[model samples]
Target: MISIWIYATLFLGFMVLAARSDARDLRISNRLTLTMAASGLAAVGLLGGGAAALLVAAATGAATLAIAWVLFEFGWLGGGDVKLAGAAAIWLGPEATLAFVLATTVFGAVLAVLLLVLSRWDMMLEMVGSHWRTRLTADTISVPYALAMAPAGVLAILARFPDLF
Candidate 1:
């Protein structure tokens, strides 16, 4: 039981860090994603998921990578976003993978609308002159999709362990 709490905390912690980094830098570092994947696998295994956890994580990651590749080709996602989502899929596994994807899609749509509105506001756009902000405000580039992916991943995790709360 205590291990469950630790796993949840670790998952949320890494997700938060990834979200923040993606928002600020317009990039999700591979180091963070890899660490999150490793810790998540450990957590799930420690919580009695065993080899099933490994298989699920691997399958989910591979599937997400394939989908991400298509999204990347269409200029709908960044490479960092692809890596982040694939790593996050490992944590979410097969059972919650659909929920995670749905949440991410919903959140991404909302974020896109929000960025669209904010981009039009000179005041909002001027608040942060960072490269990320520029990319967000630009009409051509994609948003930092990890912003949506991470939080949705957290929600999926929470849903997976409803009794934990």
Candidate 2:
């Protein structure tokens, strides 16, 4: 039980860090994503999930990576976003991974709408600092997708561990 909470804390912590980093510079570092993946595997093992559970988690992560990579290639998502999602899927496992992906898609759509609304407000964009102002004003919009990923991950975690509440 204590291990589960520890895992949750670590998972949320990484998600928050990833979101913040991506929001600030639109970059989710390789080190951070790798650490997240490793910690997820470690958490599963520590919780006595055994080899089969670990294998399932790993397979889910791999599948997420493959699919997200295709999206990245098509310019639908950034490389960092692909890696982060894959890492998150490992923590979520197979069952919760679907929930995470669905929640992330919904949150992403909401973010896109918000960005469209915000883009029309030049004053608001200016107040957001030059980095964001430039990005928001660009011909092609690039969202900090980690923002969606983080909250979706939280929701997935909660859904997977209803007893935690």
Candidate 3:
């Protein structure tokens, strides 16, 4: 359907853009984030269901952003991760977004536990390194945490709603 097509386009485009943002010479700013945020929400609105559905997505998305902010404030998250969380909210709605967050949390926790069992906390620490109480330099950072998981969540939802993209 048209919705699926749009969602597919948006998903692919977002991934490409995000990846591009990760390039060595690229520079991301708040303006770019806002533009992407708008587009990302629109994609969710059109692809997920409708305006009504988007309303749900918005609420859920806000919750996701709020939680991310809290974590970020505690030096537990990155700005990019917060932005990704908000972007996902625009499409997933609250319930779906919650599902995404829960899934990501479980995934991350499992990964962490696995790392610990393997005695690789030091490696895991390297990613966020000595920043549990403060942020690292903005340069040379990976993409946001939510971004890594958002696609998986969206894909799972799309699987359930075959009509969606």
Candidate 4:
């Protein structure tokens, strides 16, 4: 329980890097998320119950690496987002990851809708459309979506896995 605060601080440090960096090379988000997942468990383990925490830590680490290779590299999603999500999983563990993912998906969808609704079509065209016009246009990145969804995921995990807490 107290360990959750430590994990949150670590995650926040990652966010600071993401906000400060002007380029994509830093991979601030990806690494941060991964750290959150792996360390979150280990920290809990420090409170005792080593076996489950270590198992989750290992599995989440592997999954984070795979995600980095695919999603982050492909630019489908940011590295920080990937890493942060994984870290949150460390706190939630395997059984809760699913619910957390579902929460993230739904939260992301709502955010996307909100962004679309807030902007007029003409403005949208000017912003996203121009980028889309380019054959290799990168999708518009939303730090808030990732940041906001992470905690929501954590809550979702907690809700689903009360025993873990």
Candidate 5:
């Protein structure tokens, strides 16, 4: 149980860092995604249900990847976002995966609204830094949806390790 807590903490920490990076650079590193996926597998294995967990994780990841690929083809999401979401889904499993998706969808909408409002104010945009200002103001830039992804991942982790509260 304690080990699970530790794993959950680590997972949440990395997720927060990924969200920060995505917010700042619009990119989620493959290294971070891989680490998250590995940690999730390790944690699941520790639960004494390694085989079933692995299968569930694999299936969830494949499903997420398929959905993400379609979204990517439609130019709605970036490759990094796809990879990050798929990796996180391995941790979330089937039960909580739907919650993660719903959470991400809600947060994405909120982020879009906030960015839209921020883009309207020159002073606010300038304060966000030149790179972000340009992206926020650009007509074609994609939102760093990983910000929402991280929070959803954390929520799913919390659902699994409820006692962490």
Candidate 6:
């Protein structure tokens, strides 16, 4: 039980940090993603979920990375986003990983649309700080995808560990 709380706390804390960093800089640090993945494996072991569970989680994470790599290759997702998604999948395990991917896709689409609408409003962009103004008004329109990923990740976590609530 204690291990579950620790696992949840670690996952949530790292996710929040990743979201903030991605939003601010449009980048998720490799260090943060690596730590998140490593900690998730550690948490699984601590939970006595057994070697099978750990292997499943690892395989899920690997599959996610491979898919995300293809997305990156197609120029659909940034490298940081790929790494972050893969790391998140490890925490989500096999079943919840599917939910995370689906939810993240939906959230990403919504976020992109919202950003496009908001960007059209010059006043709205100006009201925010210069840094945000630049981010929102950029011609390229890079979505801070981790913002979308974070909420979906939280939902996945809750779904995977409903007893925690």
Over 27-92, each residue of candidate 2 has an lDDT whose tens digit, in order, gives 999999999999888887777768997898899999999999999999989999999999998888
Give per-model TM-scores.
Answer: 0.88, 0.96, 0.60, 0.59, 0.90, 0.94
TM accuracy, model 4:
0.59
**Weakest 10 consecutive residues, lDDT, candidate 3?**
132-141
User: How would you encode candidate 5's per-residue C-alpha lDDT over 11-75 as one tens digit per residue?
Assistant: 77877888898988888898988887787777767765758878888789789988988999999
Residue pairs that clash (backbone atoms under 3 angstroms), model 4: 29-79, 29-80, 30-79, 30-80, 33-83, 33-84, 34-83, 36-87, 37-87
Model 6 lDDT, residue 110, Cα: 99
lDDT by residue (1-165, candidate 4, tens digit) is: 455555545544544454344133324545555555555666657745678767865686567547644866776566566665666556555666667667767766786566555343445556654433331232453434454454565565466446545
Please say which candidate is ahead in TM-score: 1 or 5. Answer: 5
Q: Is candidate 4 or candidate 5 better by lDDT?
A: 5
Candidate 3's displacement at residue 94, Å, is: 2.5
For candidate 6, report its TM-score.
Answer: 0.94
Estimate, for each residue in 1-165, the C-alpha lDDT of model 1 and write its tens digit.
237677778777887898899888788898998887777677666777578767878788889878988999998988888877787777777767788889999999999898887777778878866775777566675677878987797788877777877
Which is the leading candidate under lDDT? 2
Q: Alpha carbon lDDT of residue 111, candidate 6?
A: 95
For candidate 1, give the lDDT of residue 20.
94
In candidate 5, where is summed lDDT lowest over 10 consecutive residues?
1-10
Candidate 2 to truth, TM: 0.96
Give the per-residue lDDT digits (tens) of candidate 3, residues 69-105: 9987987566766776677556555555666677767
- The lDDT for every candidate, in the order shown, is 0.79, 0.90, 0.57, 0.55, 0.81, 0.87
- What C-alpha root-mean-square deviation, in Å, does candidate 5 show against the real structure? 1.7
Residue 64 in candidate 6 has what lDDT?
A: 97
lDDT, candidate 6, 80-117, per-residue tens:
89998899988888888888999999999999998898
